[model samples]
Target: MPFPHDRPTRGSDCDCLPRPSDTKGSDAKASDPKPSDPSPSDPALPVYVLRYQDAWFGMEKRVTFAAADLDAALAITEREPIGAWAELSQDGVLLCRRGGEPGGAADYWVVD
Candidate 1:
């Protein structure tokens, strides 16, 4: 099915609304219809940005990866260095920050 962006705008002769033929009917058998929720295998999963900054050296690195939610992002942060600071952002907006201080929150802060 064509997304809104892919469709023709108003006043187009073809209308360009998604054609009913593009979708399966109720009686039709679906292909991969039951995709697992929040799984890495799902191509529609949301992508998040993880930025790491060294406390002393001020070195910075950014990683973009797919995650289902904040908890998944926290799980990925477990592999980061203990003393380094990390920030999780989505769509260029800061979601939370963690690390860089002794006995900080085990997970992250400022966002659920």
Candidate 2:
């Protein structure tokens, strides 16, 4: 008895995998669309700053703040005591309006 053998078929109907370069152009365009300018409704976005005990001293600690809106929040943070950080959250309840170290000095307090 002889063993059965199968031959491979080649045609458009065949299910061969595509080569890497086959979809390069179209895929590149779709994947690399030009970035757009910032939108008004973008999130507050988080940022941080370190306050050192002194100019030569290493970072003493970090301060945190949150802006309900991005531009206003950034502006508010910019005008603060020294170093301030900001983060955007749908729920920033843990964050109080007050500015200070998480467990240290009290800088500014947020008023409801």
Candidate 3:
């Protein structure tokens, strides 16, 4: 007996994928949707500075980044594998702090 090499039957009539003619224009490419860099002073994401004391040497250290709020900033700090205690600041003003004990506390409180 001979084996059949015919193509498989169509599964459905619906076309889920978009066709090239449905695109915005002929000049449009898949990679053309790159977003512009956000400005440093973007209001949606305020800049924050995290200060902490090195657990091993007790030397002060700092890190800066943009976050949605103090909670987000603290979340980012918690992810870092650094000093046990850290202070989150914005515009040189202290907002909150975390881990201020010898054994390294797990909770952080607002400065106010």
Best lDDT among the predictions, by candidate number? 3
What residue runs in model 3 are displaced by over 4 Å at the alpha carbon? 1-43, 82-84, 102-107
lDDT of 2 by residue, 41-74 (tens): 4454453332322223333444455444545554
lDDT of each: 0.68, 0.43, 0.70
After superposition, the stretches of candidate 2 with alpha carbons farther than 4 Å from their true spots are 1-17, 27-34, 37-60, 63-108
Ranking by TM-score: 3, 1, 2
Cα RMSDs of all predictions? Answer: 13.3, 11.3, 7.5
lDDT (10s digit) by residue, model 3, range 7-106 = 3324433345555555757765766644555545667788999888876788888888898777777778876645667788899888877665556555
Estimate candidate 2's alpha-carbon lDDT, on a 0 to 1 scale.
0.43
Question: If candidate 2 were superposed on the true structure by all CA atoms, what would the RMSD be?
Answer: 11.3
TM-score of 2: 0.23
Question: Going through the candidates in order, what is the number of backbone clashes in each?
Answer: 0, 5, 0
User: Which candidate wins on TM-score?
Assistant: 3
Once superposed on the true structure, which residue ranges of model 1 sit more than 4 Å away at CA?
1-43, 55-58, 102-112
How many clashing pairs does model 3 include? 0
lDDT by residue for model 1 (4-61), tens: 5665665454644645654655555555465454565466777788788854567897
Write the number of the candidate with greater lDDT, choosing between 2 and 3. 3
